[model samples]
Target: MAGSNFGTAAKIAAPLVLGGAAILAGMHRWESQELTVYADQLAGGLPTYCSGRTQPPRPVGERLTQARCDAIDAQTATEYGRAVLACIPADKLDQNSFDAFTLFAINVGKSAACGSRAAQLMRAGNREAACKALARGPDGRPVWSYASGVFVRGLQSRRQYEANWCLTLAEAP
Candidate 1:
């Protein structure tokens, strides 16, 4: 019977695994692809490049080919996906939920996303609350929309968008 349960689980998870390409394509609209390295003055001059990537920041004015940017984006998505998945059970996640969480992780770093109230609610099997938590916390205020202790409008918009994405499979008002 346990083997049968595993098979059932695999069947449920198959679509999510197969939807990787679609998710990647959908994410493009949310992530801007800049071929040249630039510093994000909004985030205290955080060096960024290649679709909002901010790791091993390249020197300012450095340029990369579209192919290289694509590669880096793919690699970063995969890395962040693994990190997010490590903290959330695969069995509990629909493709939309996973994509939303992965997007959040990409923006806020894996540790921050994984440790967030959203992740906690999801892990506790409360999908509705989890989606709402992405936008606001227990205080009924926006969360994760701050940079250097100041609220950022763009980040707030992104968080609300991600929250809506998370509610795709759920009935939300």
Candidate 2:
């Protein structure tokens, strides 16, 4: 009877494990979509922002092919993901947190993101504080503030989104 009960438990657990994996995969896919949309909005598709040389020198402001645009977008997302993974501890991140950090890093650059107060807080296991810290720049000003003291609406909106993602309890995607 004990052996039969163990087999029954295993049967139940197997489905649960598979279901959890499916859910995680779905979450990752959704997160990737969100990142692409946000990045496309930030970086227009007009001219390719290629880091390396292309076959033909694609000058700035020149229109890119649809295929080229897609390739660049995908490349940017991959680079940002790699940067976030390299800078942050794996155990400290959830999907939303990772997404938020990725966006922030993309905007502010890897050095700033890695050295941020939020990163420190996260490393110390203070997620709430880390979330709050996302609103400010490296200079301690609101992220929207320019070096000349002007505030940009777009930057403000982006910071708000990042903060919301950081603070929200729900998993992203």
Estimate every model's Cα lDDT from 0 to 1.
Answer: 0.78, 0.53
Clashes of 2: 0
Task: Provide C-alpha RMSD values for all models, in order.
Answer: 6.0, 11.2
Cα distance off (Å), candidate 2, residue 11: 25
RMSD in Å for model 2:
11.2
lDDT of 2: 0.53
Per-residue CA lDDT of model 2 for 1-173, tens digit only, reads: 65332111111111111113323332233333221112132333322233221323355555555566446545555566567667776556665566677667756677788888887877766676677678875566676334245666666666777867767643334
Per-residue lDDT over 1-173 for candidate 1, one digit per residue giving the tens place of the 0 to 100 score: 55432112122335355226645664576668889988888668888888788987689889999999888888887888888789988876777778888888988899999999999988877777888889898888999999999998888988999988877762222
Backbone clash pairs for candidate 2 read none
Q: Score candidate 1 by lDDT.
A: 0.78
lDDT of 2 at 28: 36
Query: Which regions of candidate 1 fall more than 4 Å away from where they truly are?
Result: 1-15, 170-173
**TM-score for candidate 2, residues paired by index:** 0.60
